[model samples]
Target: MFKTIKNDLPASIVVFFVALPLCLGIALASGAPLFSGLIAGIVGGIVVGAMSGSNIGVSGPAAGLAAIVLVAINSLGYQNFLVAVVLGGIIQLVFGALRLGIIGYFFPSSVIKGMLTGIGIIIILKQIPYFFGMDKNPQGDFAFLQVDGKNTITELLNAINALISGNISVGATVIALIAMAILILWSNVLSKKGKIFQLVQGPLVAVVVGIIFYVVTQGGSMNLESSHLVSVPVPDSFDSFKSQFNFPNFGALGNMEVWITGFTIALVASLETLLCVEATDKLDPHKNVTPTNRELFAQGTGNIVSGMIGGLPITQVIVRSSANIQSGGVSKMSAIIHGFFLLISVIVIPKLLNMIPLSVLAAVLFIVGFKLAKPSTFKSMFSLGWKQWVPFMVTILGIVFVDLLWGIFLGLVVGILIIMIKSYQNSHFLHKEGEDVDDGRIKMTLAEEVTFFNKGAILKELDNIPADSFLELDVTKTRYLDNDIIEILEDFGLKARERNVTVKLISERGIEENPKSYIEFFKREIKRKYPA
Candidate 1:
C-alpha cells in the first residue's frame, strides 16, 4: 500500500472531492443532520476500507437509500432511527457471516450491465439540476419522485425554463463550464504528458479555480453564495467536533417499526454494496475480483460504526467508486486516505472547502455519468441480440421511470420470459430415415435433455407416424427426462400396438422389446443412466 502511495494519494484526493458533497447531499436527502453523512463517509473510508476484500471499491453514504432513510427518520425520529440503522448493520453482519453475499451473483450479467447504465443515466439526470443551479432539491438526490413534489422529468422541464428565463446563477454556470473544460482537457490531453500532470488532477484544478472565482467575484454580478456552494458543517472547537458524533437510542429496540426499518436498510444497503462491488471490479483496470462475502462483512462493520456515530447508512456507492477508478486509484489505501482527507479537511480547512462551488462537483459527476452510460454502451448491448438487448433496454427504462430495484426486477422478468420461450422451441428435433433403411420407418432423436416443454412436439410427431410403421426411438444421449415427457411416452406405447407401430427403445440398458409403461421404465431408473 505504501509503495503505491504515489498513485493512490492523488486518486484518494479525487475521490475525496467526489465524496464530500455526496455525503452531505445524501444526508440532507435522508432527512438527517448534514454532519451525519460526513460521519458515514469517514467510516466507510477508514473502517470499511480497511476490512473490505476489494482493492478498488470505495464505500460511503448511498443516494439509493435516501428515500428510505428519510421516511424512517421522519417516523422514528433521529435517535430512534439510529437504532434501526444499528440493527440494520447487525443484520448485514449476519448476512455476511452466513455467506449470503453470493446473492449478488444471481443477477444476470445483462441485468448488471443494465443496472450500471441505469445508475449512470440517473446520476446524469439527478445532477442536471445542480449543474443548472436549480437548488429546489438537494444535490445527489436520484429518486423518480423527488422530495420537492416534482419527478425527475418535471424537474428537468423546470430547469430548462429556468435556464431560458435566466433564473440561474451566472457564477455557477461559468464555473461549471470552466471546470468541465479543465476535466475534458486533463483527461483527454494534459494527463498524457506525464505522471506529474496526472497527479494534479483536473477536478483539483477546477475546484481551486472555483474557489478563486468565488473569492474574486464576491458581491459581483457573477458571485455565488449559500445554495450555490458546498456546505460542510464547520466545527468551531474540539468539543464541537466531539459533539457531532451521534448515538442510537436503545429504547427504540422494542419498536416493531424500528425492526422493520432495520431490516429494510440491511437488505437494501447489502444489495447496493454488492452491486457496486461488481461494478467497481468490472471497471478495475487491473481486473481483480472482489471477494463478495468479505465485502459484505466490511460493509456491515462500516454501517455499525457509522450508525453508532449518528451517521446515515453506508453502501459501496457507484458514483464515488467510479470516480476513484477514473482518477486512477490503485488500492484500498486510496479509499482509506480519502477518508482521512474527509476527516482532516472538515476539521481544518472547512471554510476553504465551503468556498468551492457545488457546480464544479456537478461537472465532475456529469463526466463520470457520461462515461458509465456512453451511447456506445447502448449500441453495444443492442448488437448482442434481442434476448440480451430487451432486458437491457427494459432495465434502463425501468430505472429511469421507476426505481433501481424495480428496474432490475422488471429486467429479470423479461430475461426469464425470453429463456422460457427459447426452451420451448429448442426442446427437440426430428430426423428422416436414410434411403438404405426400410420405407415407413422414421428415426426420432431426443434432445440432450427432454423436459416437459418437448412433450407437445413429441406428441405432434407421434400423431403423424402412420399406422403399421416402424419407429426407432433413441434415448441414448438424452439426460434429465422430465416425468411429463415420460408419461407422454407411456401413453404413446399403449396406443402403438393399435396403430401397428413397432417401438424400439435404445439406451445404455440395451435395446429393449416393445417397452412397457414409461413410468415403469423410469421407476426402474433407466433414465438416470444418461449423463446430465
Candidate 2:
C-alpha cells in the first residue's frame, strides 16, 4: 500500500478535480440537497475507495442514477427516499455476499464498448450547459430537456441571453480559458520533457492556476457575476457536522413505492458500477482486474454511509477512475485519500471550495469529456469487428439520443441478435470426404437443433452429391433436425430417384422415409418420425 501511495497521490489530485464538479453536478441533478453529492463523493472516495480492491476504479454519485433519485425524492418525499437508499445498500451487500460479481463478466465486449462510448457522449452532453455558464436547470440530468421547462439547447439560449444581459463573468471566463490552456500545455507538452513535470499532473496545475486566477480576479475592477463561483454550504465546527446527518423515516420503509424505488436504485447503481469497473480496467496500463464482488460490497457500504449522513447513493464512476489511472494511481489509497480530501475540504475549507468557479470545473470536465468522446475511440471500436462494432455504434446512438441504461440495453439486444444470427449461420455438421485414402466421395452430417439458416448449406452440399456409389449421412446422433434440413433431405431423396444415387439414412431422431415433395414430405415425415 505504501508503495502504491507514491503513485496514487499524484493520481488523487487529478481525480479530485474531476470528482469535484461531478459531485456537485450529480447532486444538483438529483434535486436533492447540493451537499448530498459531495457527501456521496466523499464517502465513495474514502469509504468505498478505501475498502475497494480496485486499484484505479473510483466511486461516486453517478449521473446514471440522477433520474431515479429525482423521481424517488419527488414521489416518496425526501425522508422516505432516505429509507430506500439504506435498503438499496443492503440489497447491494446481499448481491456481493452471494458472489454475484461474476455477472459483470457476462456482458459481451461489444456491449461494454458501446457503453463506454455512450457514457463518454453523455458526459460531454451534460457538461455543455456548464461550459457556457448555463445553470437555469440541474446539472446531472441527462434528458435533453428538464421537467423545469428548460433543456440543453434552451439553457444554452438562456445562457446566451444572460451573456447579452451582462450576466457572464469576465473573470470566470478568463480564468477558465487560461486554466484549460495550462492544463492542455502541461499535459500534452511540458510533461513529455521530463518525469518531474509529468508527475506534477495537469489537472493539479490547472486547479492551482484556477485558484490563483480567482484570487487575482477578485482584486480586479471587472464586475464579475456571482453565479460563476462554486457553492458549498460551509460548516463552522464539529457541532455543525452532527447537524449534517439525516435520518430516514423507517415507518415508511414498508411502502410498496419505497421498495420499488429501492430496487430501481439498486439495479441501476449496480449495473453502472459493474460497467465502469470493466471499462476502467481496460483503461488501466497495468490491466488490473478489480474484484467486482468486493466492489459491490464497498459500494453497498458507501451507500449505507451516504444515506445515514444525508448523502446520495454512490457507484463506481469511469471519469474519476480513468483520471486516477491516467494520473498514475497504483492502488486504492489514492482514491481513499481523495475521499478524505472531499470530506475534510467540505468541513475545513468549504469557503475555499465555494471559491472554485464553475467555469473552471467546466473547463476541466470539457477536457475529460474530450478524452472520452474522441474520434479515435470510435475508430477503434469500428476495427474490433461487426459483432463488436454494431453494438458499439448502437450504444453510442442510444446514449446520445436516448438514455444511458436504455442505450446499453439496446446495444446488448443488438449484440445478442448478432450472436444468434452467427450461431444460426454456422449451425452445420461436417464429415471428412474420403473413399479409402484419397477418394472424393463425400459424407454429410446434419447438425443437432439446426435452424432455418442451415437450409442453404444443407441444400448446396446435398445437391452436389454424385449420381454414383458412396454418400453417407450420419444423423444417428442428431436429436432435432430442423424442418429446413429435413426438407433438403426429402427433396434430395426425390432427386436421387432418377439420378441412381445411393442414399443411407442413419438416424435416431430424423425421418426414415425417402419421401415425395421435399418440403411437404419433410413436414409429414418429421411428424411421423417423432410422434410426440
TM-score of each: 0.92, 0.82
Give the per-residue lDDT of model 2 (tens digit) for 83-132: 89988999999999999888888788777777766766766766655655
Candidate models: Cα lDDT each: 0.85, 0.76
Predicted structure with the largest lDDT when compared to the true one: 1
**Candidate 1 residue runs with Cα over 4 Å from true position:** 427-444, 447-471, 495-501, 516-519, 525-532
Instruction: Record all residue pairs in model 2 with backbone atoms less than 3 Å apart, i.e. clashing.
Output: none
lDDT score of residue 420 within candidate 2: 71
Error of 1 at 136 (Å): 4.4
Judged by TM-score, which candidate is best?
1
Global lDDT of model 1 = 0.85
Q: How far in Å is the alpha carbon of 269 misplaced in model 1?
A: 1.6
